[model samples]
Target: MLTQEPIYPKPFLKWAGGKTKLIQQYISLFPQKIINYYEPFLGGGAVFFYLYNHYFLSSAFLSDINPELINTYLCIKHDVEAVISLLQQHQANHNQEYYYYMRSYNTENSVERAARLIYLNKTCFNGLYRENSKGEFNVPMGKYKNPQICNPEVLRAVAKALQVAQIEVKPFETVLNYAKSSEDFVYFDPPYHPLSETSNFTAYSRDSFNKDDQIRLKNVCVELAQRGVKLIQSNSDCPFIRELYKDFKIYEIQAARAINSNASKRGKISEVLITI
Candidate 1:
């Protein structure tokens, strides 16, 4: 008998600040071999899918602070078709009435909730997952003529990829504390502290990931590096970021925004890729 490796698909939605472009450049920074992988901030999962596709890693720990985002991952893992069916139904009537209803509704199962979330993401303004004070999906209707609503194929593929990973929804510190000291790689993509006040948009929720969060994240990375865990973190190339990883190697890269609404603000921007 012969064994076969897994093949995963690309992320389905258009994610703001997704690291698809430079993820490959930082691959070499990861541990050469590891017992497991840990990603605390798994937005769009660009790095997760990248590793799952190219490497032989079979066990991993995937987590996110946003419950809705984690729910989407779990839904694709356990109930791909059901979520797809619900999303297809959402596609049928994407007017103001149905959109508001779906946004306000709640469910016992994460899969159903995740279906609604994905539907909203596909149809919302610029694919942004902004919410209101009461935690409702509040982004307005998008301008897509005929977007791909239910991608069952990519869903199934991600589901399979997730089978080899343990998914958790928790804080970055908690996730890192649970990981072993060695033979594990942790990739940090925390909500970046904005370069300027005009550009502050951290979407784990409406609550901002302020300078304090960035500082704490740096402390965690320094500890992880000292413990023999390979670390590669990405954030905006700003003074705070440079000072945080002063002893580490930093690389500058240009990233084009794919989901930003303003076309003028969608051009290349400088970013930092830190490895320790």
Candidate 2:
């Protein structure tokens, strides 16, 4: 008898602070028996997808503050064929002008909007998802010689992985309502605390995740910890983050920084994985 190869779904979006590189180091830290998996800040969903592909998670609740991102996931989960069809159109018409035109395009259709977001993400400079004060995606066109805009196989795999998961557009604190104590594992991968004053890139939505937001996240983590929810959080290795997660087991790991415009700043940096 012949066995089929495993098809693991990678992140559909190239997200900033994605945990693809850190998964190896984190494998031992993931809960051994996760009844319910929760990833509140579901950027890239690298870890969530990995866990779903490998583990026997009964359920999952994935969420993010970005409505468009969540909508993209929802589109993939519920209407992947339509989303892929729209992306095929995007792939055929892809050009500098079309990129800019689609960037500013608004649509009431969920599948079309999701396809547009995925197209821009693949073709945008550095694959950085940014929005201006007016809540418009302002990133310019990237210089990829051939960016894959409509990947049917990956989209299908992602749709399969997301079928058992509930994707939502909500704040991080909202997970407390759905997650049960002792049985649920919550993974927090929020925007990292900037290493320096000029390195902040937390404009995931139009709203910025400022220092106050970090404090609030720490408070939420504390409450969840008290409630017996298994928790693991990843953030930049900065004094503020260390101070905030001082009570937890902070494991410092080095990860390559690839998103910085300045090549000098795009090197190995210290990041912390806090487990509780």
Task: Name the top lDDT candidate.
Answer: 2
Q: Model-by-model lDDT, in order?
A: 0.80, 0.90
Which sections of candidate 1 miss by over 4 Å?
1-7, 95-97, 258-262
Per-residue lDDT for 80 in model 1? 81
Relative to the true structure, candidate 1 reaches a TM of 0.91
- Predict model 2's lDDT versus the native: 0.90
Query: Scored by Cα lDDT, where does model 1 land?
Result: 0.80
- Cα deviation in Å at residue 149, candidate 1? 0.9
| Candidate 1: 10-residue stretch with minimal lDDT | 5-14
Q: Estimate each model's TM-score.
A: 0.91, 0.96
Model 2 residue runs over 4 Å out of place are 1-4
Q: Model 2: how far is 158 from its true place, Å? A: 1.0
